[model samples]
Every structure is written in structure tokens, then in C-alpha cells.
Target: MKHAQTFEIFLIAPPGLEQSLWKEARAKGFPSARYTTGGVTLKGGWEDVWRANLVMRGATRVLVRIGEFRAFHLAQLDKRCRKFDWAKYLRPDVPVRVEAVTNKKSKIYHAGAAKERVERAIAETLSAEISDEAPVTVKLRIDDNLCVFSLDTSGEALHKRGHKAAVGKAPMRETLAALFLGACGYDGQEPVLDPMCGSGTFVLEAAEIAAGMTPGRARSFAFEQLATFDGDAYAMVRATLPAPQRTSLSFHGSDRNAGAIENATANAERAGLSDNCHFRHASISDLQRPEGDPGLVIINPPYGARIGNKKQLFALYATLGTVLSERFSGWRVGIVTTDGQLARSTKLSFLPESAPIDHGGLRVKLFQTDPLP
Candidate 1:
């Protein structure tokens, strides 16, 4: 098997949250990391790719640029792709899926045709079967007559951390939750409470971080099917992970729905974080600050656009603000909401707003407030 000493690695982030993800990548010691419009990029080896997939909390997917060439037409594209060393990068036994996109300036403008040509080249040169349902994917981009190929090393989206069997309506994705937690300055050392904790995403994520657990510990990746993958080396990478540290503080979550609390508790058990997290059935009006050093309180309340009526959500937000201000002073707060009016209804003195974040097709912003006086 052949491996490049260093190749381009792209980590996809949610729109408007690239800076947060970039900060995370840099803090993780990817010195070469820099943010693009939709993601961050770095130059790294296969091991770095493996590590990113296994450890990055904010990345939605990790892609590796394999190779590229300039070709104006289909025949040229086919000849060049065949000449490229497919066998060195792909395994003969693993089925592959190919996807392509082209710009207007490219002579090979048909995306379907381009994908078919590349698929045929791989099949002929490496004897790899092509399947639409294949776990491994080859992505192609033809812009200004230049062809670029990349591999989606992340099979399932990273947000599907392989533990939660139950999810609530408008459930926040784990990647998005991690980025929000980072934005709110939650470093896992302090206790966190989510008053509207629908499936306990915020609470569980905070617990995992506080416990020093890697988000990918429960999941697998697509790189395992590639020809260059070294199982033994990858096993060493996993083995070398520092043990998860014990946390002194417990995370708390509450929801009005008894079923949601039950689901959240079950999800915590499945993630092996029940000991560090506690879930209860309580509404926002009933919430009282847990006795501890003041920490962070974050919530993803019911958004008007996704679930409830806007008028109804306003009162809910206002009530939330009233409860937090009256009972949870000294705790910093972060709320994720789509409607600015709804966020304002909280009446909590918020700091400057965050960039609009894309969550489940709705634009949401994080509203933060300093420790209440």
C-alpha cells in the first residue's frame, strides 16, 4: 500500500460556524489548519486523517484529497484517470461510490458522465466494484477544466456518534452542540444545566467532554476499507488515547416531558456517561439552579419555525428568562433560537449576537449573557 507523507485534509463545519471549528482545529495542534468558507483545511498524513475522524468534536465529515489533473473533455478525463494509480489508493475487494460536479467552463460538463467515466477507470485499473450503497465514496470536482478527486473518509456523519437510539423533534446535532458549547466557553470543567433538555444532547456532550471522552470512541470510519489502511497502526492510535479522566462535577438536564427525560436518561446510559450526568422531568418554570460553584447554563428551546407557534414561544422564552434571572444568578447563559424577537423576549441582558448558524435548515444564533448579577 502507498501513503502520501502529507495530503490536503478538509474538515467540514456548519455554515457560519467555520471560525469556531477553526479555533478547535488549531487548539488540537493542527498547526497547518486554516478555515475556508465551509470548512478548515490542513496538510497531514493518513494517520492525521484517522486521528481527525476519531477525535474531532466539531467536524461533520473529514475528506482527503487524493489527486487531481487538468482535462478539458471526457476522453482526456478518462485517459488521465486510468493512468493515475488507482490500485495504490483503493482496495480491489471494497465497493466504491463515485460522485461528480462540474462548472460551466468545463468541457466535461455532464456530472453523471464524469462520474461514470471515473467509475469505469477504477473498475478497469483496480478491479474495484462500484456500488451506490458502498461505504467508501470518491468525490470529483471539475472547475475550469481541472479535475479534483477526494475521498470521504467519514462513512456516516460524525453527528451520529452511534450511541443515541432515541431523538426528539428538532434535536440538536452533536457537532453543532459541541461548537455551541465551545462558543459559550464551556471547557468541561464546570457544571452545565440545560433546562429545556429535549434528548439531553447538551448535557451529555458536556459530560463526555468533562470526562475526557473522545466523541468518536463509539463509532467507526470509512478509511478502514481503503487499500492504504493499516489496522495495527490504527489500533495503536486508539490504544494510545489517554484514559478518560474522572470529573468532579455532574451535568444536569431537565424537560417538561416525562418521556423526554426518560429518553435522555437512557441515552446517557448508552453513552456510558450516566454517572456524570443527571436528567429530570421538570419544566423551565420549575427549574432551580443546582447547588454548586456557578458554571454555565445552556439551552436549545423550542424554536417557532420548527415546532411551535411564534407567539407561544415568546412567552416560553420570557418565562425562561424570568426563571434564570431570579434563580440562576452568577451562571453564564447561552440560548440557541431562530427568532431574534423570541430571543429578545427572554429579557435577559444579552451580549453581542453570534453569526447566523444553519441548523436543520433554519438560521439560529447563540445569545449569551454574562453571569447574572
Candidate 2:
């Protein structure tokens, strides 16, 4: 049997993704959980941590919930902080950081004071101190009215795939890009195109998927820092990350901006996907299908706020719709945009097929049209 220890795990995501995660957790066989804005809480262990990191399409961060204690006053807070088993997971040599969030009704009005108590507690109990005034080891987060302590198990944001050293402006994050692709039912078997391929995120992600790649394989997770973490198990995990088979699929992307095309090409090469994905400079007014393979057309066009011009933004979206409706008649389409109204200007009739999604603070939405005409 697998060793299972109950931890109060918190799965952090964008604001609206909580419900989706809740549904995902149930479908994926996680136990019942409590949820709030930006996250969900449940019981899990290191294996659960690994599974969540590797498999969860929606989760941005998986926080291993250490402990949570409540106190209305400063003295009470300090006394309670010292009682945690910080020693179990922390070491004296490893440095740490402290954070705190206080509610309106509490006497602990000063977040600084709460952080001090936790820092003192860690030093006294674990014989280790927090100095991430340029932190080295532990990280902390305090939510509204509550301090739910966790060690940062994902170091850099999960989206920093270390692949896209060159990026397009207003770039969508890798993890978010992956989740949205999954939401669109991209199985890596069909040809994929990005008409507004800013930075080539969709094309690159599609190429990686087609090549049977795991998004987390190329990066180091913060969990590797845990005192109880096992390296041998992780190596085994990494070794199994690649799929057994690869396929021949065309991932195509186009942008009117010459600079963006160059950046996309460089990023694709950096991601080891240059051979699988094709990047070109073309306006949405002229995007066309490749010779073969019926597939999905995914786009992330510039909204008014992103590009700062409303008329041009609507025109771009409108052109994107025109190309989709006329040229790519048999292809499926998925358009990601923050502006529902701007997307409305696309006038694709398939506009009703949209699904709302969230990315960090942004309320993102996907308008999907299909090949089933």
C-alpha cells in the first residue's frame, strides 16, 4: 500500500477557477475539500503533491497546508505560533520568510506584528530563522482574516517553463495556456493553428503535446526543498514524464508583427519544438489552412486594454472571425479574450459556444466553434 499522510493541502488558482478545481478534484478522485477565492483546501501528502503538480491542468500552485491557528490578539497569536511542529519540516541552516494577513475585526491590526510572531516561533521551535529579506528556503502567505501557513512547493511560478526566454508582449502564461488548451479538448492528434499567435503559446504548447511531452518535466518544483522530500521518487517521476510514443502533427502560428514572429520562432526553438511547430508572419486577414489535417484554430487576440485602441481591437477580432468563418470552414476554433464585447464584434454566430475561465486576476473567456458544420 502507498504511504498516505493527511495534510491540509491548498490548491491555488485564479479567482473563478475554484469551482472548476472543485469539480476536477472530485472527478480525479480527491477527497472532499473547502474552497475560497484563489484556492481550495483538502487533505493530501507528498505523492498527492506530486500528482497535483503533474496532473492538475487548472491548479497554479499546490500549497502543502502546514497548519492554521486562530488568535484575536497579539499575545495569543505569539503563544499559539510557538506550538506548531515547524521543526518537522524546517532546518536551522535553511533560511525563511514570513507573511501575514489580518481581518477587520481582529485586534492584530498590524500584519508586521503577526509576521514577527511567526518568525520568532520558527526560530525558537525549529532553531532555524527567516532571513528572506532575500529569502533562501521557506516562503509564506497569509490570506484574509486567516494565516494558513504553507511551504512554497512550486518555486518559480509553474508558468515559467524555462523555455520561452524570448516572449511576445502581453504573453499568456504557460500553465494557463496549457489548461485552456485542455479545456478545448486538444488531444495533440490534430493539426493546431493560432491565427493571432502572439508569442506562439498555443502553437508551442500544441507542439509539445503532440511530441508527447510533460509540461512540468523541464523544471524544478519547490517541493524538492522540503526536509521530508525524497529525491529518488522524484527522479522516478521525471523518468516517466515523457509519453511512450510521439506523432506527426503540424502546429502553425501567424502574427502580423514581424518582431512577434521572430520571438515566437526563437521561443519554439528554445522549447525544443521548432521542428514540430511552424511560425510565420501573416495578418489575421490572410491566415489559411495547411495542405492536410483537419484541426482546431486557437487564437489570443489583443483586447482594447492590452493594445489601448478600441476600434483597432474590434477590427482585429472581426478579421479573425472572418478568416475563421470563410477560409477555415471545416476547422474547430477557440478564441481566448478578456473582452466579451470585443469577441461579440467577431459576429461568428458560434459566439454562444463560449465558456468563461479565469487567469490569475483576469476574467478570461473562450469562444469555441467546431468543425461539425
Candidate 3:
């Protein structure tokens, strides 16, 4: 009897957030997990994969690397696919989708040809028909003359927890928001304030974590459709989830846009996290510190993509600097912006920081400030 094989967990983090993802993976009790530029690799079963998809905020998606082999040509790819133990993991009745990626040094550089070969191999090997529109997606990567096959345990990106009904104009993905929050060291034991909380994402993710909620409970994943899936095991693991802590974590968010406030409120409600999170209609000009243990303040203000101009937005940064400098002494701050000029106008020295995150093709930086002196 062959046992379930162990696979690597690929965590696609925002460009500058690798350390945060690695730190979170360790804190999740898989401390031995190794990390790389874009993600972390860990050992676990499907249950662990499911747990990672739900709880790992730092990861855009959690992928399970199932197969790795060298295939220099179409014949080699077909042979390798046929030799793979598809019967061990896939379900005959469940639909399957195969995706392929190619890079330099590969003769089979044409991705469409590779995808067709792999599909035919799977069909011929398993006597099953191929379907392009399956609910479950199997990912293939052929880079640097190496072919790696992985399963996207997360169906839609993990950010779409099936909750957020309303989104801001320059809305951030929930996964990216959580990862950014983690990068800023949001531990939930301390107050978290997002002055420019367009859709209340930073505050909401914080509230959920503070309340002891498992990010996966409120969502579903694609791995459940696999033939080898164990419902009993998953149910037991899920049953062990800690209850949402109802403490006053002081999760606060405000946006100048009235519509943004309303959207945040509705999003928080939909996430079942309204109790711990608060959204108000306010502006960066009106920010002040609240009395509590010193916590983190994160702002994803306008970066001139959808709102505000470079010159005009400097005023916004100046306002943010004034607000943080005056009221939130001793509170840590993180500001996301694309322009070094805009960051400089804040009048705060954010020395020794990494390059900006490349989100949507924009070079964005996470500027950190020293505690009030």
C-alpha cells in the first residue's frame, strides 16, 4: 500500500513580503519550513494544504508540487505523464484542468503543444476524457529545462474568501492585504488602525485574527473534490478550530469616502467580523492616536493609479506625516506608495527599506517610520 506523498507548498507572496510569509509559516508551527523569494516550502497532506490556503495571509495562493521530472521533448513529457500515478490522487468522476508554463532552454517551448501532450497522456493513461473547464486546476511549470507539476489547492485566489461584495476603486486583494499586514507585524493582540481603509480589509483581517477565527472556515477550496480527499479527517481538523476571541482588540479603520465606509461596513458584516472591526467616515487629516498598548498603523492611501495626482497627493502624505507625528507617538507605521518623491514629502526618514512591491505593474514601497521620539 502506497502512502500519500509529501509535496512542497508554494506560497506566492507580494514581492517585498517574503520575510513576512516565512515568519508566518514558522509561527504556524511549521518552523522548519524553508522559504524562497516568492514563497515557502513545507511538508504536509491535503489537510495541511487546505489549512494553509485558509490561514496563510502572506500567500497569494498555496500550490502543492506533486510531480517533478525532466522532459526535453513532447515524447518525454507524454511518457512522464503516463508513468505518473494519476490513479493515486485524481477522481474519475471529478473534472480536471491542466495548465502549462514554459521558459528558456526547453525545446517544447510552445505551451499549447505541451498542454495538449500532457492532456492526451493523462487521458490515454487513465482512460478518462479530457476537459478544459474542470473545477480543479493542475499547474505545470517547465523552467530552466525542468518540468514541475503542481496542484492549485486554492480554486480562486485565496483572497476571494467569498465575502467582499463591494470593493474600492483601487481595491487591494485580501491576500495581499493580509500579507502586507503581516509584513508590518500585526499580531492582533495590539490595536490596528488603517486610516485609509478603503474597503476595511486591513481592519477586517486583523479583527478575524484577533477573534481567533480560522481564515479557512468561512471559505471553501478545490482540493475537496479530489478522490483521495478525506472528509472525516478534515471535519475533525476543522472542529478543532479555536473559537473567535471576543476581546477588544481595537481594530479601527477610516476613509474619507462615504461610499468606502459603507462598503467596509458591509464587507465586515459579510465576513462575520463586524463585532471586532470598526469603520468610520474620516480623512487622513483627522487621524489621532487612541489610548491603548502601542500597535501598528498601516495606510494604503491613494498612489495616483486611480485617485489623486502626484503633486496633489503629496499634500495627502504631508497630512499623513503630520497626523502620525503628532498623535500616534510610539505607534509603528507603514505607508504604501509608488513614488519616492511622495514618500520623501512625508518628512519621515524611512531608511534601509527594500524596493517597492510590483503590484499591477506599479513599483510600490512599504515605508516604515520610527516610533515617536
* Winning model by TM-score: 1
- Compared with the true structure, all predictions reach lDDT values of 0.91, 0.72, 0.79
- Top lDDT hit: 1
Clashes of each: 0, 1, 4
RMSD of 2: 3.1
Q: Higher-TM-score candidate among 1 and 3?
A: 1
lDDT of 2 by residue, 74-113 (tens): 7877888888777666656666777666656666778788
Give lDDT: candidate 3, residue 23: 86
Residue pairs whose backbone atoms clash in candidate 3: 211-244, 211-245, 356-364, 357-364
Better of 1 and 3 by lDDT: 1
lDDT of 1: 0.91
What does candidate 1's lDDT look like per residue over 98-195, in tens digits? 99999899888999999999999999999999999999999999999999999999999999998988888789999999999999988888999999
User: Candidate 2 clashing pairs?
Assistant: 132-135
What CA RMSD would you report for each candidate? 1.3, 3.1, 2.1
TM-score of candidate 1 relative to the true fold: 0.97
Question: For model 2, what is the C-alpha lDDT against the true structure?
Answer: 0.72
Lowest lDDT 10-residue stretch of candidate 2: 134-143
Model 1, backbone clash pairs (residues 3+ apart or across chains), number: 0
Tell me the TM-score of each prediction against the true structure.
Answer: 0.97, 0.87, 0.93
Question: In model 3, where do residues sit more than 4 Å from their true spots?
Answer: 1-3, 127-132, 306-308
